[model samples]
Target: MFGTKVIETFKEEHTGDVLDMMRDFEVKKRAISEEKEGNIVLRIPAAFAETYKSLNSNPISKHIFKGRFTETTKLKRDKLNINVGVSKQFIARSVSNNIEHAKRILAENECSNISTILLVGGFAESEIVQERIREAFPNKRVIIPSESGCPQRSSSSWS
Candidate 1:
């Protein structure tokens, strides 16, 4: 329960293996307003004994966390500590590499005379990407359409 809303609920029989269950859950799409760093607590039904047993039996689980797990019956939820530092670094690197590639493309194609750089698509919505592009090409005007995904109309809606 994340502040009173249930995100996911699964039957005990469905999640036979704990490791595979956790991996599958982690890969699923989740909505977050902003990026944050903290341990994500998952509240599973008490009947899910595989979660507890796997944590105890598997030494491979230690690869996820250096901290010790303290199981408490009084607690309603179980805590899963995962470090996304590597994943975050990978995304940052990919963004940087793409920006560098854009620069190379411009240079190789002799696009120096191009006055305006219009960024469209979903990736253009990223403030970091927009900021970096503006910084990279100080002289060129970086224009990001307000509703990038939507086509702009020249005439009034009534007409």
Candidate 2:
């Protein structure tokens, strides 16, 4: 029943809820491909009903636009409407914060003249992150070994 018209109409009218925002972030973390862009749609499985229902008191979370969301059918694939706006600035700012923290530590220790940087975590494996680090510390050497895989793997690999 989730035809093109239904989906489009829902997107146009939905302001989005906290659950939608969280869902989008979760999907982005799993998706490392830089090729994916533009609006992202996520299907809220019926299994997550218990968790979503608990957000009634959240001021930031809005109610799903009533009939916009279809009920739980026998197929278990319910159509729900939720929009989450995410900007690249969010990611850039997060990484920038860490970089700033590193700068602070170096300044405090009077070791501001750092040269080499070894990125070993999975986040370090991110192309955007690697590029950012390179740009931020252009003069310094940034080396990320091939062993750095996903974050979980990267952590264990370093260990």
Best by TM-score: 2
RMSD of 2: 11.3
Over 4 Å off, model 2: 1-27, 30-36, 40-45, 54-87, 147-159
Provide TM-scores for the models: 0.43, 0.51
The candidate 2 region of ten consecutive residues with least summed lDDT is 68-77
- The ten-residue window of minimal lDDT in model 1 covers 1-10
lDDT of 2: 0.53
Q: Compared with the true structure, what per-residue lDDT tens digits does model 1 show for residues 37-156?
A: 443344444434344444445332232322223321123334343333333344467568988987888887588677898988655665556766788889889898886745677778
- What is the lDDT of every predicted structure here? 0.50, 0.53
Off by over 4 Å in 1: 1-88, 149-159
How well does candidate 2 match the true structure in TM-score terms?
0.51
Deviation from native of the Cα of residue 127 in model 2, angstroms: 1.8
